[model samples]
Target: MGRRTLVAVARPDGRYDCRIAHWGVGADPIAQSRPLGTGLTASAARTVIDATYDQLVVLDGAVRTYVVCWLDPTLSDLDDVVLARTADPDAFRRWWVERKDEACRALDSDGCDPATVRRALLTSLRNRASSVHCLDDASFLRGDR
Candidate 1:
């Protein structure tokens, strides 16, 4: 599969959370696909996403318009007021990954899958953020349309 242009979000640990952006199939996480070579560490994929964003759209404007704020792992309130106005993929990654890790730890099962936990987290967050475009992934992040 060829590596297509995508809206990639940065994780606090420097890993990118990449996804598809078109066909109305938004919010589809592509990290597991491994077709785009997105598994490469921070700098490699960062350059890819950065270049894509910088060249395709105004980098600063895109960042400002499409914001993905990762709420606290322990947060029960998913209000928009609690969300950040600016883009912060690093913070989102930190909170999201940490929450998934924490949930997996609490499972205490023999075969607890972290990916499953992450999906659950995404579902829950998506439910709470149905009104606004959270831009948590390329699929969800759209301003150019």
Candidate 2:
């Protein structure tokens, strides 16, 4: 994370407010909350943020993970945040896998076909959203996501 970055907040009117602000005090030179845009839809806000900032975070209720655009290709496996953050890694892993499998089974019951599943799986393996939406869509096909 940088000293200053762009952050967005959803408003009561179902729009977004984006700004370039620092997390520090005393009016830093980096940037101020100048209202990058107002009355913007979520998608338009995302587009503005993508064009203006290198990273973004979801700060609706809690401090969530920031954007991860690039990673060292030499790493063997990316750590699952649940496993990495939990006190009991083994227990959390079991529970996470079970819940994931259950969700996949439910999706399978929802009439998702095989070819679509394969395509979704491939897409997720390539690049995925933080919430793992594509992987969720394809997890039922091969019993994994």
Candidate 3:
């Protein structure tokens, strides 16, 4: 099974380079506005993140925004979120690769797979979130889509 967690990297300093994106609640946890490596830098990342809030469009309050806040690396020895709800974030990436592989298995099929199209849809989302929400599901791999 694949697990999805809000991913982040630590700088030499105390601040973190966290990816800011929205993970929808209920049904499908994977929603629009997924991260596309924008938070790799602490300096310019914030400016880019602020743009998300400005561009946000709420459809009758159906969509909510959340940031992936990793557990502090300094407080613990673990490099990543030690007590993540599911598997490591890297596992999530691996799952995407596997899914794409399966989808491309058919010789008759052409164009992009679900994962590829998803990565392409990555966009800026509202940033400066105060907390993290944990809601992960691997249903898509079970042919849920």
Local accuracy by lDDT, each model: 0.37, 0.39, 0.30
**39-136 per-residue lDDT for model 3 (tens digits):** 24444333233211211111111322232222321223222211112223344334434543444453226554544433332211112122222223
lDDT of 1 by residue, 86-114 (tens): 24434443554466566656555545554
Each candidate: RMSD to true structure? Answer: 14.5, 13.6, 16.9
Q: Model 1 compared with the native: what TM-score?
A: 0.29
Candidate with better TM-score, 2 vs 3: 2
A best-first ranking of the candidates according to their TM-score comes to: 2, 1, 3
**What does the lDDT read for residue 100 in candidate 2?**
42
Clashing residue pairs, candidate 1? Answer: none
Give all TM-scores, in the order shown: 0.29, 0.38, 0.21
Model 3: residues with Cα > 4 Å off, grouped in runs = 1-87, 103-108, 111-116, 119-145
- In angstroms, give how far residue 102 of model 3 lies from its true place: 3.3
